[model samples]
Target: MPAIVGAVKVINVSASSIFHIGDVYAMAPKSSAKTYAGGGSFNTGSGIHIQLSDSHTYVNDNDKFDQTIIGT
Candidate 1:
């Protein structure tokens, strides 16, 4: 069968996430997190340190995978 789509709108899409329209068989999404640290030299013994964090979910694997079963 077929579909008649009209006025399709997509707001936003992020990494490691998927949005399908018609049909999908198999989906395998993998994501990871990483942290970075740094130190700075201060004149006084007491100092405040801050670390910036990353807020992105990147897709590690992009394999669609194999499908065996189908439906109508």
Candidate 2:
């Protein structure tokens, strides 16, 4: 099977007006600790992980994901 895995670096997303689940955004200043999910992990096709080292402001409460942020 064809698969892709990478570490994505992100920054300055707090003020963005638009958000989408699968939308790709470029990184500024390059963060770290990105991981891609696989089929065996959860019987799923593909996935991505994004993590921030420091606290960031949210526009609203709805943006927060229900699951644990670190291990998701």
lDDT of each: 0.57, 0.44
Candidate 2 per-residue lDDT over residues 1-72, each given as its tens digit: 444646656664654233333435553342234344433333435565645456443343454444443432
C-alpha RMSD (angstroms) for model 1: 12.8
Look at candidate 1 and tell me the lDDT of residue 62.
55
Per-residue C-alpha lDDT of model 1 across residues 1-72, encoded as one tens digit per residue:
655667879999897687777656787666656444334323256556656464444456556543423231
Those runs of model 1 whose alpha carbons end farther than 4 Å from true positions after fitting are: 1-6, 36-72
TM-score of each: 0.36, 0.17
Stretches of candidate 2 off by over 4 Å are 1-5, 17-72
lDDT of 2 at 43: 47
True-vs-predicted CA distance for residue 7, candidate 2, Å: 0.7
